[model samples]
Target: MENLERTLSTWIVRYRWWFLILMPLLILVLAKGLDLRFNGDYRVFFKKDNPQLQAFNRLEDTYTQTKNVIFLLVPEEGHVFRRETLVTVERLTELAWQIPYSLRVDSLSNFQHTEAEGDNIIIRNLVQDAPGLSDAQIARIRDIALAEPLLVGKSIPKDGAATIVNVTVQLPGIDETGEVTEVATAARALADEIRAHSHLSVHLSGMVMMNASFSEAALGDMDFLIRVSAGAMLVVLVFFLGSFGAFGTLLVIAMSALAGMGVGGYLGLPFTPPSASAPLIIMTMAIADSVHILATFYQELDSGAGAKCRREAMQESLRINLQPLFLTTLTTIIGFLSLNFSDVPPFGDLGNFVSVGVAISFLLSITFLPALMILLPARLPRFQFEIHMMTHLGNWVVRHRRRLLWSTASLMVLLTAFVPRNELNDVYVHYLDESFAFRQDTDLLDKYLGGLYYIDYSLDSGKTDGIHDPVFLHKIEVFANWLRQQPEVNHVNIITDTFKRLNRIMHENDPNQYRLPERRDLAAQYLLLYEMSLPYGLDLNNLINVNKSATRVTVGIQVLSTREVLALEERIHQWLSDHEPALVTEGSSPAIMFSHIGEQNIRSMLGAMTLALVLISLLLIGALQSLRIGLASMLPNLIPAGMAFGIWGILVGEVGLALSVVTSMTLGIVVDDTVHFLSKYLRARREQGMPSESAVRHAFSHVGMALVITSVVLISGFAILSLSAFYPNSGMGLMTAMILTLALLADFLFLPPLLMKIDKH
Candidate 1:
């Protein structure tokens, strides 16, 4: 290993010009493939074979692959049934059909009102001739809208102050990258036009807008968060590494980030919110390698006897740091690659991209950084205070080893005990902070009409035209009623509602006849009459399949935590099992999909992290060449994440998909400090034959400051990331920063004392 590193360093110095020129050109060539496009589709989070996603796909395929663009119309007078409001709403509903890919539009004006005159059924738009409607007609419209189950909670609020115009769009699926944005753009333009000409306040909210916000939030973070991270990194680097040397470190990290993101682009990975954070994470992680190499090089130059020239000093730095750097880089890569085990694909992309960045950083740190150091007149400021602080800290730990060992151990145990305080919870709407207009509009929609959180169930009766069977219709009605009874349910869109309405209309609009038909023939006839009277695209195709063997029931719930969402789903499933087993199926929707994945990811990431921990421990056992020290190293390496979780449990008490992979990420990162510290300590003990106490002091004096520098940089980088408007990115940043900070604490206070005690045996 030593000979290889020597030869590599010698080659780098001998062919410095070649390395300096070729590395950038290679990175540039890779950068040419950086054609990154942001995809905010909720589907991006799930794998193709994911059960919930598959169910959703099957459900959509069975009927319409509909994406919704809902415009919330809140009149200034807070009365939606007024003549002018009805007139404006009628015009807006007509205009909404013009939205690109719109397959259907439903609003107060377009709601199909059915009536009976002399045994003939009549179906037409509810709000016709809106400009000529008198006060009596407007009041009758309000009375009819409020009385209708289908319109009450789904479109118009029970209070009748606001209503929604929902446009059902079917994207061609050939160009999903921009189709959602196109729909949202057209919707927003329509909204602006309505606001300009009418007294109504229009706010956009629906699945399409939410998807569009994903791209908006991701693109916003890439520009804003990356710049914030870069500025923070610049200040930290210049302060710690001196101006000229810091520039080299910055350059190395920048090139590494480009390499990582370019590799992702070359691999055809779209930038989702999670993956969009790669550049900032890459910059943060890449710094550790450059800092380690440069710290040693500067130390050698300061020694005044270790090297005769800058080139020799760099080579010596490379020789000393090469093994530890390689070990850390490999372990980190292994840790990140475990993200492939995640249920969520975007997290896997994040992990893979960061792994690439870490590898590239290691390569450039040893080659590009050193070559540039040799060419540039780089002079780093000597930190006499840092050395003195490390020296004193080492002495302090030696003096109070027993106290620190017990105290830190007890604290770690106490914090680890609090780990269960964290409950798995993810709310997709809350993923974006209030800064996003989508979130604000969604909140308003939830406050007014109904919830955006919905669950879709495709209930199959298992035979042709089985939907008309009295028994099947009864079960559907029972389930819909059961859903309506749930506290979380804001609305239930069921075919039973239409059947009851049609039954009453067929019976000369008798109020007492507003119930399900008792006979199969009657139900079939009612459905046939209703479908025949409906206009094209407004037919029952969305609710009932062509064969009438199955129907879809969509239930909207108030905004709730993912834990609550999953609990409601469990309750629903249990109800179906107890009462209607044959009609039972997994609920399919973006909300349900996200709800299931957060729990699944946490479980999978833990398994992956456990495997990574085993592999990393074995590597440590080999690298340190001391089974005892390697075994001891696990104490510090593992405790930091547990302690961080404990702190999070106390502070936040909620773990989401973003927090699920923190253990794996921080495990790899925190190991770098332990490896460097333990390696230095073992060198003093085995090679110099120093006592354990002396070895502890030696480790602290040699590598303690480097650990601090890297920790501060990493922590600062992620802390800046916590400022992101996107919750997943911000939560990850905050949690990672917390873990890295704790890792440093464990390495400094706990590792030394534990080492001294363990080695004594």
Candidate 2:
């Protein structure tokens, strides 16, 4: 392997001209396919066969698709019943139909109100001629709406201080990416128009707005965050290398990123928030290879090798770093490829893209980087301060080997103790920070009106039109009543509400008659009469299927954690088992789906991580040719992840979809420091026949500065990602940075001392 490394380095310099030209040309050709498109749909988070997603799909097929945009109107006067506010709502409701792909629009002014007059049932818009309504009429409207079950918590709050105009858009599903943005844009424009002339404050929230925010966040990160991370890498590069020409490192990384994105494009993957950070991540990971080679090259040059020996210096640098770089790249690719085990498809895309980029970076670092360095030679000033600091650190660790090892081990144990504190939880709306309009509007909506988080159940009755049976209606009413009693539940929109309203209207408007009809025939007759009287777009299709075998019961919930969401789901299922077994069905909604996926992802990644650890350990044992040292390397490699989670548990105490993948994702990265340190330590012991103490010293002096430089670059790169408004990306960034930092410390502090004690005999 040493001879092979020497020969490979010789050839890389001998054909430097060819390597520099041919490699970049090949990369650019591959990068030509790097046409990335953005998709922000919530459904993108789940696989096609994901159970919760399948349930949501079935629910949509049975009833109206839940894709909607809600415009919340908060009047300056603090009441929605005022004439001007009503007019603005009425106008917005009318114009909302103009939004692309709009299937229906529901608002205070367009609420279908049913009443009885002399044995005749009258159904009309609740707030008719809003601009001409008298104060008495507006007061009546408020009184009736506040009393209504269907509209109160959903469209209008109990206090009637705010209202939401909901536009239900039936996207063709053929071009949902474009259609979603179109509807969102139109909705925003309409809201802006309303705010321009009315005292009402308009805010938009719903699935459509959330979807649009996903696209906006991805595009924003692609535009801004990548540049920020690159600039950070640049500063670190210049500060360490002490030369601007060290920028050739950035070019190698950039090409690697471009090639990675190109692979994603070639595979026809969409850029989601998780996957959008691929470029920055590829660049960051690729930097380690370049920094290792460059550090060695600079060190060789500072040994008084003249400019004429620059090629020899680079050749020697490549020869030393080749094996470590290859090992690190292999492990990183393994770690990221493990993401394919994730329940979320975007994460899989991220993993694949990055793995490919890391591979390309290895190829470039060995070939293109070496070739480029010879062509444009960099003259780095001596990093005496950095060198001396590493030397001092090594000597100190050897002096207090026993004490330092114990302390670090103790610290690792203490941090790992907190790991169990992290609970699996996801609140989708909170996935985006308040910097997003959707999050801000949704937060306000949760505060004043009710929850955007909901659990949808498609209650099946086992026969056609069975939903009209008095038994079925009674069961639904019981279930809805039970949900309403739950503290986490804010409102329940069951078909029973419409039935009771119609029944009371049929009984001459008597409040005492507001109950389900006793007989199935009577319930059927009442449902038919109501359906016949309702206007277009205000029919029962959203709640009832054509055959009426099942009905959708949408239970509005508070902004609860994923744990609370799952708990409510369990309670609902348990209640069905106890009281209404035949009506049992899996709850389905974006909130519920998101809740399940986070836990599922964690489990999947655990299996993948176990496999990766085994593969990496075996490879390390083979490469280092020492079974004892190989097994010893696992301790430092594994401790960083546990410690990172422990730190997260102490600070946040919650882990979700993004956080779930952190362990597996950081596994490969943290190993880089371990491999470099252990490789050098073992070399000193075997080839140079150094003592344990001397071996530790040699490891630190040889690879210690390089490890620090690379870790700092990687940490800063991810730290910049923590500033993203998208919380999943931000949390992953924050946690990954923490893990990398811990990895560096473990390698520098813990690994050295442990090796000394173990190898002393």
- Per TM-score, the best of the predicted structures is 2
Please, what are the lDDT tens digits per residue for candidate 2 over residues 168-237? 9899988788999899999999989999999988999989999999889988988899889888888888
After superposition, the stretches of candidate 1 with alpha carbons farther than 4 Å from their true spots are 305-307
Q: Against the hidden reference, what TM-scores do the models get? A: 0.98, 0.98
Q: For all the candidates, what are their Cα RMSDs to the real structure?
A: 1.5, 1.3
Clashing pairs in 2: none
CA lDDT of 32 in candidate 1? 77
Question: lDDT score, residue 211, model 2?
Answer: 91
Question: What is the alpha-carbon lDDT of model 2 when measured against the actual structure?
Answer: 0.88
